[model samples]
Target: MYADPRRRPVTFFVGERVYLMMLMWKGVIWFGKRGKLAPRYIGPFSIGQLLNDQTVVLDLPAELFGIHDTFNVCYIHKCKVDDESQILSLQDLKVDMSKKLLEGPIRIVHRKVI
Candidate 1:
């Protein structure tokens, strides 16, 4: 089939780290931010197990405990060793003990009154 030649097969192994695509919802806030600036993917989460050829379970952190662990291959991207900039650090986040994110003070860089 013509599709076969163009399609590339993606495989993931257990213990391999991968990034999971974050699905944007109307009102839900992913991580500490939301809207257009929000990250498209989160985690370099380790693969806990492969459920099927297309599905795998991820070892998500406690903060993301509410989300389902299983994900399809299309929803994940293999983590590259040299791409440190693509990874987001959870320690950089200002989360309180109650699992709430603390809002930092925002300063306006530019202002014009029309």
Candidate 2:
């Protein structure tokens, strides 16, 4: 592997909430909707059980009804919400199936040419 043996290993436990990395090629809508601007992690879903140090079962929401809940450690990351973590409500942003985020309409406040 490209990783160093001296580095600490990634770990997770049962009952911990984590964000699942969006992988797999399910067309542009799921994987490359925004090209490189797409968010890497999807949810802070709670872990139902730890199958091992490398995999865990997640309590996925209804939104992901068709997708599997069990995921590998490489596909999940621990979500640590600190004081600097801003709480965003669903009403704050508009997201479509294509994963396109719409903050608001685009307006040209000023224009300049060099």
Candidate 3:
């Protein structure tokens, strides 16, 4: 699960701003706001992609500069979004991220072009 900012990213770091995680597993989005921690899922890219690139094409966020320590999932705080969907959003997104990311039946579709 993404949006949680705690879920693993394809890449990430500490003290960074918002993240645009590309999910590779099926699960729930859990943020560390509640003083909880989990393995990262996607990445720690800077807010640049979401800020400059209209399509949210992120490689790595500039703010992810000084942090290093990264880990895989072990502990986490579940979010409101269901983990049975392909997308993780604050809205009504339903899909299995764990299954889809491991499976080959997923394709990424965005709302705009980069």
* Per-residue lDDT of model 1, residues 1-114, tens digit only: 556677778888999989888788665546656777677877788999999999999998888777888988999999886566545575666777896878885457698999
> lDDT per prediction?
0.81, 0.73, 0.35
Distance from true location, Cα of 35 in model 2, Å: 2.2
Model 1 vs. true fold: TM: 0.68
Candidate 3's C-alpha runs over 4 A off are 1-16, 25-40, 50-54, 61-114
lDDT for model 1 comes to: 0.81
Could you say which candidate leads in TM-score?
Answer: 1
- In model 1, the runs with Cα more than 4 Å from the true position are 1-4, 27-29, 82-90, 93-114
lDDT by residue for model 3 (1-114), tens: 547866654332233333343233445444321222332533323333322212332344354444332323222122323333544433233337453323343466656868
Instruction: Give the local distance difference test score of model 3.
Output: 0.35
lDDT of 2: 0.73
Q: Residues 1-114, candidate 2: write the lDDT tens digits.
A: 998879998777777778888764655236333557656777677899988888789998776677888888888888887532353433456778786776774457688989
Clashing pairs in 2: none
- Clash-forming residue pairs, model 1: none
Give the winner by TM-score: 2 or 3. 2
